[model samples]
Target chain A: MNSQQIHLASRPTGMPSQANFKTVDVTLPALQEGEVLVKNTWMSVDPYMRGRMIVSDSYIPPFQIDEVLEGGAIGEVIESMNAQFPVGAKVSNISGWRTTFISDGSDLTLLPAVGLPDQHFLGVIGMPGLTGWVGLFKVAQLKPTDTVFVSAASGAVGSVVCQIAKLHGCKVIGSVGSDEKADMVKAMGVDAVINYKKVDDLTQALRDAAPEGIDVYFENVGGAHLEAALNVMNPYGRIPVCGMIADYNAETPQPGPSNLLLINTKKLTLQGYIVMDYWDQYGEFVEQMGQWLKEGKVTSEETVYHGLDQAVDAFIGLFEGKNKGKMLVKI
Target chain B: MNSQQIHLASRPTGMPSQANFKTVDVTLPALQEGEVLVKNTWMSVDPYMRGRMIVSDSYIPPFQIDEVLEGGAIGEVIESMNAQFPVGAKVSNISGWRTTFISDGSDLTLLPAVGLPDQHFLGVIGMPGLTGWVGLFKVAQLKPTDTVFVSAASGAVGSVVCQIAKLHGCKVIGSVGSDEKADMVKAMGVDAVINYKKVDDLTQALRDAAPEGIDVYFENVGGAHLEAALNVMNPYGRIPVCGMIADYNAETPQPGPSNLLLINTKKLTLQGYIVMDYWDQYGEFVEQMGQWLKEGKVTSEETVYHGLDQAVDAFIGLFEGKNKGKMLVKI
Candidate 1:
């Protein structure tokens, strides 16, 4: 039997291209006593992975040259030797960018069947969902009456952030790159949606949207979005920095918010966090998100590509703001 | 009786000049019921006052044009109509930039002798002392094993911050503008001192001083010093912002740290706070700091100006880095 895998051929200098990755076919050996041969179904492509592609020390190690690039993936056990990993069982794992793989079962998490689609475990019920929840309730400490401004509010993590803030009875304002994304985020019940592409000054747009000033800012896109948030933040405003996808591929360091002194004048707090740091909250997150799904209180969406060959484009599409929600590759 | 007061004559474009203030002699009215006459002894000149000099809404109201400028002041009650404030009793009040004043006794806090010099209450046992304590244990959440970096370490608040962190058994690194200030901070038991004036690259200097990453950064001077702290901060570090004296006089906005994306990569928390917000903890701070002062565990210092005529010069001297510790005008 054979499996196909994507390897990081070289590190990128600026925006990454298909030339940075190489695909290879590998002949699978017989599984060892504790190993399970699993076939991957869906793989996630995220902005944080862009950080991992560079050759430097970051929160996580950079992807090595000619090694299989890894990320969130859903798979089904086709052959198993361990009692815990029965054949036909579906699982969520991190050994992505491959169509099939043999796992020792340590890195795999069994996904319980709740009648929702299995690929959702890669998005709304998984990392992106958890990121939104933690960034809102824990990091930003969102209050019931807090006026929240979420950048990239139509994307996976941000979409959930908007919905969760709304569920908490917060007044939500969102910013998106296009009118189509604006419509989608508005459907999620945001109080106002600004199409940043059409706006001359994001700071003025935020002021127009939130006349009373925002109490919490969920920062995803960093550059001007962060500047806009700072301009209209109320006293004691909280900013939970989840990602800076806007500057992830910049050849030079982007200038930070010039109004950062307002951090002292307004007594603001800006905290940066990665979702992996909050794994201890996973079970609680899954339960609450599952209940929200069951009650139809929240909606999940994805932009999907059909095969592993489209993985590179799917990842690149994220930087171009082409994805409506979670960008995934269906293998 | 006549009282001399310094009023804000005009707002400054960049650095304030003596021409921006006007001194006036006015005959004070007889004390009303429950009023007292406070003869000012020592008045504090702080960096935060620079923010108030600008005509804009901040955490506190901006100093109004042609209004008497007021801040932390220590005075002796000369005549009292209130039984709680007897004559000859020292108190800490906010009716500063003046030699004497008639007060309603509501704004006065009676000072206890505590066997120490009375002016110590204005620095180590007063607002600046309370600021250092609150910033260390409350805002930054400093641990005993933590490594701390203090900017403007020879100034009023940063001096106490260095001493308190040292008493708590933490490795402390301090930055000052000159070797004289560096020696003063070193006497406070800091593990290392970086004379920023002598260093070509402050970031490299900080890296050399704190070979291991710093756990907390007490921010007072917020330009290159902040940039250096961000570069050497450990993962999950805390920054309690107190002031940005470095840019307080800029006519145009100064760009913030360009490498601020490290806030996300390092999972850093930058919090801005003012001492006024933490007044509820004053009793605890005074009690602990009082004991430390008595036991010789901590020492207090001040640079004094002789009279009301030098008040403007004393305030302006702060920007020139003329003072070693608390900068006060002995009126």
Candidate 2:
């Protein structure tokens, strides 16, 4: 018998409700040939998951009804028949929201390191880390003197972007929702932080932060913040768009930017990219980020939640700016 | 002994008024040693000229009140004392809104005959051509088999983009203002043409036209057209913003596709650029465009205004979608 299980009950309209989720306690399925049973150690709750709930045709499919919600996760193999993933092996995969999952050899890959916290595999040294590096250095083409402005400054991707900018010898400024987050990001080595909610004129605040104007904008939260960033961006600026958590739960996203045309007049390069699209370059990216990690050139932070039942609350925290770093759920 | 000129009488708030212009014929100062006085034959009337008149901080300085409005023009050197440019030599330069101009041999570059019409210099061989090539090929990084949706399908820059897409074996679709314009673009070998003014359901129209989804969007008219384009874009689609003529004459451009957050989820890339920044590559651009023209691979359409007095009407036609191709004032 398994301990706990979670499944998708209904598709969400705007922000998801508890009614959309179904928590269950089901007996574990018997492992078939070449299959293993994984006891999920940690699961990720991200803005991208909100996209997966809708029936819209996208690069990826929406979650099927009654199926377990899946994302990047780290787990432990308690029963394995496959030699590649023996019993007691720590593994990582996109296994769904279940305490114990019976699967083929496909979903789980063996977790590499011995001592590192397994949760960090779903945060810093994993997908989020790849997202930050790919968006900044490769897509935005980060230069040494380039000034960077990240929205949602204290999120997993934004926090790492600030640290990476510091290591790259670039000026970094971030916009967050609270004074505490602003302070926390400042501790992350960002040169300046703006409490966007406290400021009446975001444009004026950005001008004060980046006098020469931003060269790289790692856009995470989009809305009035993007409007403000657009006004302060220098000519030839590169905006590497990774996410827009602001509108993730919105009933209707903001229509479009009014001054989007300024992109032409200012000669700006606002590029939007999905991280998995750059999967071919992952080995090279992991190499660089791993080197940065060992050299103390990059650091990571996380806001961890206790269990599977708290996943809903962890996701809701993103909208309210509650997480200091990545908002995660540990099971 | 003199030159007739139209001087910038005032700065415009939205669209330039007749009062914002002053027509005058002035005596030309005597040419110094190594000087030439070129008789301007054709002056390029562009949408950018409208923006340049009002904006303060830009690549080019705003035209001073009562000073001749300066822009790119092709001219015949009726009189020359400079060795590099002899009499009857054709050249392209920023000589201003005037009939004759005296130069000290500093700015003007002699036009090389790559075997296309002189008007082609203003259209396919000039800034518009360079803008399309660089924005599509360089900034957008368009690939073969990529689907492209271009706004202002039959206009100067957009027309060339359609040809380039066809040359690179891309499935090209375009948005225009009228059925006539749509027919014109179709003749250019674009796979599909949707009249944006006629179609209210632009997203549906684009989906019906390019069902696979848009990979490259050559943004010329950035309003509802862009909003529609964003809805159906494939992940990692590229928007090379060249012109947004839809809002150029409005008192305040309306907010569009507020759902710009889609840029992140879909991983769309939007790089806005002004062609002058890519002037270093002009030689290569002209050579390629020239070869395409000679080989009968690409062609152009020009709406020639007979005199400088018609320049205002010609400029206004762009907003109304009245011109068939590159709008030029022949003096």
* For every candidate, C-alpha RMSD to the true structure in Å: 1.3, 2.2
- For residues B1-331, what per-residue lDDT tens digits would candidate 2 score against the true structure? 7998888788877666777887899999888789998998998888888877775566577778888888888888878889999999999988747888898768888887776777788888898888889988988888998999998878988899999999999999988888888889999998999987787799999999998999989999888888888888888788888888887877875886766877877877788888877899998998898899999899887888888888777776776778877888899
* Model 1 ranges off by over 4 Å: none
Q: Which ten residues in a row have the lowest lDDT in candidate 2 chain A?
A: A112-121
* Cα TM-score per model: 0.98, 0.95
Per-residue lDDT of candidate 1, residues B1-331 (tens digit): 8999999999888888999999999889999889999999999998889999987758888999988998999999999998899999898999999989988888999997578888888898889999999999999998999999999999999899999999999999999999999989988889999999999999999889888999999999887888889999999999998888888999988877777778899999999999999999999988899999999999997999999989999999999999999998999
Native-to-model Cα distance after best TM-score fit, residue B83 in candidate 2, in Å: 2.1
Candidate 1 lDDT, A1-331, residue by residue in tens: 6999999999987899999999999989999999999999999999999999986658899999999899999999999998898999899999899999999999999996677788888889899999999999989988998999999999999999999999999999999999999999999988999999999999999999999999999999888898889989999999998988878999987777777788888899999999999989999998899989989998897899999999999998999998998889999
> What does DockQ come to for candidate 2?
0.70
In terms of TM-score, which candidate is strongest?
1
Highest-scoring model, lDDT: 1
- Candidate 1 lDDT for residue A281: 97
